[model samples]
Target: MSTCVYVQLRCRPGTTYDVAEAITLKEIHSELYSTSGDFDLLMKLYIPTGEDVGKYINDHLLDVPDIERSLTTLTFKAF
Candidate 1:
């Protein structure tokens, strides 16, 4: 089964849009949203089976420009 995760992105001031667009272009996220609080965006994604979660996030999301930081949370049970 795929690994489900929620990633919170913190972007450089005025660059949130740029970051969002870049991420959307990748077409890797299941869902993404703009939110208030410590993070500018929240992304839901499914890492394919056998993929390393940390490396997957680093190789995909972390490379996008304007993304200053990220926090990833792994899910256990859906219900």
Candidate 2:
């Protein structure tokens, strides 16, 4: 089964839009949004079945340059 995760990203000053565009170009996230908080961008993604969640995220999402930090929340159940 696919794993659903929400990732919160912190970007370098003046680079949030660049980071967002880079991430969007990757075509990996199910949805992406700009938020007000410790983090700048929030993304919801489905980790494909049989893939290692950590590795998948590291390779695909976290690779975006100018992203200063990331917090990943894994979902255990829908309700």
Q: Looking at candidate 1, what is the lDDT of residue 6?
A: 98
Once model 1 is optimally superposed onto the true structure by TM-score, how far is the C-alpha of residue 43 displaced, in angstroms? Answer: 0.2
Q: What is the lDDT of residue 8 in candidate 2?
A: 96
TM-score of 2: 0.95
| lDDT by residue (tens digit), candidate 1, 1-79 | 9999999999999999999999999999999999999999999999999999999999988999888889999999858
Clashes of each: 0, 0
Off by over 4 Å in 1: none
Report lDDT (Cα) of residue 44, candidate 2. 97
Model 1 global lDDT (CA atoms, 0 to 1): 0.96
Whole-model lDDT per candidate: 0.96, 0.95
